[model samples]
Target chain A: MEVKGFWHWVRHTLRLFALYGKMDTLGLMRSMGMLLTMMLSDTVLNIAAVMGMLLLAERFGGIGNWSKYQVLFLLGYGGLVDGIINVFFGYNVAFISRRLGRGQFDHTLIQPQPIVVSLLTEGFNPAFGLPSLLPGTVLLGIALPHLVLPQIAGWWFLFAINMVASVAVVLAFQFAFGSLAFRAPRATEEISSSTMHLLMQLKSFPLDGLGAVLTGSLLTAVPVGGVAWLPCRALLGMGGGVTSYWLTPLLSMVLALVAVVTFWKGLQYYGRVGSQRYSNFGHRN
Target chain B: MAVMSAAGFMGDNALFLIDYLLRFLRVILFFALWRLILHGKGAINGYTLSTTLTYTLISEVFREVMECRTWLESGFWDGSVSMRYLRPMSVFAQYAAEWSGGVAFRLLTFSIPLLLLSSLMGVNPLPASPQAGILFLASLLLAVFVGLGIEYLFSGLAIAFRTHPWIFNRMRAAIGEILSGALLPFAFMPLGLGKIFSYLPFAGQASTPLSIYVGQADSPRLMALQLFWGVVLWLIAGRLWEKNKEKVVAYGG
Candidate 1:
């Protein structure tokens, strides 16, 4: 059944999480060890990425017209987006093609819940999800003081909106690409991962110096710039025009619309035909 | 895994396509970044635009070829590693063979195409000198062994700590990027810092070979250093494995 209303969705999601959140096959000591290690490694990885950019800015005064603080802000935004993706769709749940390819989408279909709600909550993982948040928050804490926003409240409001938009854009983009598993499940099962990797790798790159053609391609063709760079420029007051403020949110809405449509259509086809590869023996990996 | 099954081969093909495309875009982006930074200047720390581009191109291709992770982790984590004990070949020999097979596929499929794409983009793949070319190949061969040493070291750590492969793998790649000069060249760092990083064992992985290729560092001294690290790392990894052999936690009956 399709979940109705925002509160209803939240209720169902919470119930499912409360029931199944403790799905750690690794046991207690191992799980705790894994969490601590993940926290340490994630921090190191995040800091290293940001440090490289910061080092460049330090050496050269700044990257293009952006200051060191501004670059840090951009990376902070990227980390925040990554954290959101991880918390909401941690593990392989975001990689939906695995379900489609391995004929496991039927599990969601057989559930006593809407597929969307199932997906939204099934990957909820806050403990392990804490990895990216620490680094993102720390960097943002440092960068926020350096950025001079004339009106703190308005800037914060804009920051909050931009963050939501960035997360939506990333999730929708990944899902939209991932929905292709309905066609050639085996062939395109991993394509979504490639797309995710594309965004992850390119998101932190300073777009200021890449020139107009490449920058435009990134925005329209890949939407990689929206993950951090474009939103960052707006937040830092570097956006050259008013349209810049609306760009990411608008892109988010458009991409979300596309993703929803693509997902529903794929689901319909999946329900009717079923995955021929489906087997009694589970091999979802 | 690349050579194992039809599904695996197909997966590799898909990955290769996406990887190649990203490589194409990254070179362009990096070229633009350096160009903007240089801003009509001839060089920074004796790295002209040409040498820097060549250095990036070589490092990008070289790093991928040296990758060997999770091959050991997968077996160990699932308890299938014990199956290897029954085979005549030692676990190290089997893994070494497995890693080489994967590396060979990646070199042919991913690395060669990347270099060709770089060449098409006008990045000169030629070494700075004939002597440098010979030295680069030698250093690179040593790099393969050094990379193997690192994989085993980490594998030993995985067994000893009984740690999750997820964090261990991330930690390895993350540390490797900075220390091995994959993210930013050692020369690009502050003068003193660059010199310090260059002496570290990890620098033997990417920096030494690429540095020699780009003519920034063609000294046999660097190759000798790589040899020393390679020997040391392998020895330590072997010792660690022996000490932690019982720590292997194989789940499931």
Candidate 2:
């Protein structure tokens, strides 16, 4: 039954994309331009960030115990997760709050499909996400040989599964933040954006020296450390042992479950608000 | 008094508080990162961890002061800008006045608190001398004007490219993030690249004033360069606004 539901969503999403592609010429052009600009800027910024990290590392005689290749691997892992998120869920997640504010969310609510599925499919743009994959793939290729692969059949299996789990962790964050629209419709955009910005900044830096409390929060509650850091650690065999290697995927699953529950509860609250005729128009009430 | 009693001001304050909180958190995070990076090391590229923290705090405030909040793009897209042409004040002057009001508010509510907090935390440096303090103030004023001039130029370009004003906005943001030295200090970059960035108008936005405050840059020379760019950009923005203002008017109509 779950598999059937998944296929049903895929079919509907593909149809929506087709409709959008057929109709939105000017919007497509503008989005393409924006995507190109973003891609170029993102690549340049990534290079600069890596260089800055390298320079700092050089000044300190290298980041304590982590090589340049390991840092690059972390960066590549981050980029790959971001690229996948952008491709599948980035736009819809980013704009969900705006849609809720504008009352366009009502259209989704009225649809006979799941709200999450509808929200994810509404503004899916494959082209915008394609360029990000290039840099991510390039960086990953450069960092691959430096990684300590497991001496098992298909050692890439762990890395690939961890990458997917990392995507789930990030999506869970987006879902949790995007759910704020159900309560504070007006402030949702600001809340989501600021939250994402903070998380991105935290994730970009090395997590080793953030101490126990922050490291714990990033691994469990926030799960930002799980997004790239832990996965990179697992792949590099720097994770403490078998138990620690499995902890990242376990924590990601738990976060994903929490995100789903949060969204579901938020949807219920939204339904109650709507039935009570509580108009959050322009955030006045 | 009635307006003050109204709910709008409360709502505005609430929004401003949220923005303030986010920025405050960012400052704290960056301070922590600086601590981690330094780790008993004295300085990297001549910047002590304290000075780097000071630079980050000040740059964040300046960024808030210079932010125009997409008013130009929104005005062009929504046709509200046409109302400005009918008024006696020029469009650039109107925007400048509007932005100045916000800047004043931010200075009082945002910049002052941040300055106080950084000083309390012992991250911010006292000006090298009373003369340096005065020079820093003058350089800051010049920097703000230079930022305003660049904003006008970008706004004019947005009007000219009405269908894709976002591209201009994005480019401006990227340039500001990189060349303006808001993220990483330009001094940390290679010497030749740092020199080139320092000469650019964008550097006037944050690096020039902060550099002077930290005593890395000569106040007189940097302030002179900022003044030169300010005048040059002001003229170019005026010309561009004159040429493109009608195009947006027609497009909106």
Candidate 3:
């Protein structure tokens, strides 16, 4: 019964996405332009960041015991996770707060499907995500050979699993942050944006030196480190033991569970308070 | 204006505090990374660890002032430009005033305290000389003007391409950060490459001012270049605004 319901939601979401795609006459051209622009800018930025890291790496010869190529692998892994998140959740996530704030969320609540499912499919734009994923895949390809990992087939399997776990970690963040709209809808957008920026910066660097508290937070609560650092470390056969290899996937699962529960509670809260006020743009009194 | 100033002040200080906390964490993280890279070496690329740390902290401090998207992007997208058009003042002037107010409040509430905290922690670097200090102030004013001009061009582009103002916003941020040397010091690059980047208008924003403070570049020449770009970019921005204003008017906005 549950499997059937899930399939039904997936079919409904795809139909809605196809309908929207058909309605936009300029969608193809605009999407192409956006994809090209994003790819170019993203590539340049990634190259620059790698160059900066390389310069520092040359000076110091790598962070702790990790070599430059190993760090590059980590950077590539970060890009992969970032690409996946942007492709899947980027567009709809931006509107979630505004919809919740303006009483527009009521529309989604009235849908036959779950609110989370509806929100996820609201503005699913694959074009935006595909271009971003290209660079990540390229970077990963370049760095994979240099990494002293297991056999290629085994490493690829681990990488695939890690990537899926990373997606779960990222989705947990999106859902947790998006739930802020239920309370302070007016401020959630800025708060969400700033939090993401902070997380992005943290994930890009090696956090091993920040002592245990932060290192622990990034591993457990925030899990930005779980997406890239820990997974990369595990893949490289550095630091963590056999049991530690399972830590990120485990953490990812737990965080996703927390995200679902938190968002459910937020929905309950919204039903109680958010329905009482119709706070449209400029109409919030 | 008063309400805007108050709101801007409260909002920025609150957000600034949160951002500042994150920045402090970054500072600590980078400090350790640099230490590992330096490996007890005094400097890399002629920048001592202290000087480089100072540059990072100072740049983070002035980031908001160097940022110009608050008004232009928001006003154009939300149809608030129509309201601004109904007023007597030019839209640019209005934005400039609002930006300046926000910057002033930020400097008071955010930059000063952070500078004090950093200095107390012995990470902040003082100006090399009184001449450097004087030049740094001049460069900051020019940086603000350069930022205004760049934002004016962005606003013009937003009006011209109404559908994807977010794309322009992202481009402005990414390009602006790279060219302006906010992401990493241009000095970290090779000398020839750094010299080339210095010639661009975006370098005048944060790079030129901070470089002047640290006595890295020739002060007179850098300030002169900043002044030149400030005038040139503003003129181009004015022209772009004139050409694109009709689009907004046509939309009955």
* Count of steric clashes across candidates, in order: 0, 0, 0
Query: Which residue pairs clash in candidate 2?
Result: none
Best lDDT among the predictions, by candidate number: 1
**DockQ of the candidate models in sequence:** 0.43, 0.27, 0.34
Off by over 4 Å in 3: A1-7, A10-26, A30-64, A94-98, A275-285, B8-20, B119-122, B158-163, B190-192, B249-253
Best by TM-score: 1
Candidate 2 C-alpha lDDT tens digits along A76-151: 7887777776666644455355555444566667887776666566555565555656666787798778666555
Output the worst ten-in-a-row residue range by lDDT, candidate 2 chain B.
B1-10
* Native A-B contact fraction in model 3: 0.19
Kindly report which residue pairs in candidate 3 clash with one another. none
For the second chain of model 3, what is the TM-score against the true structure's chain B? 0.88
- Can you tell me the CAPRI class of model 3? acceptable
A199, model 2: CA deviation in Å? 2.3
**Which 10 consecutive residues of model 2 chain A have the lowest summed lDDT?**
A276-285
Q: Write the per-residue lDDT of candidate 3 for residues B1-253, one digit (tens) a residue.
A: 6248646545313433554555566666666665555456675556776777777777877888776545566665555778888899998888787877777776777678777887665575577688988888888989988888888777677667644455566767766776787766776664355668889988999899988787776888988988999898889878877887777632213
RMSD of each: 3.4, 4.7, 4.0
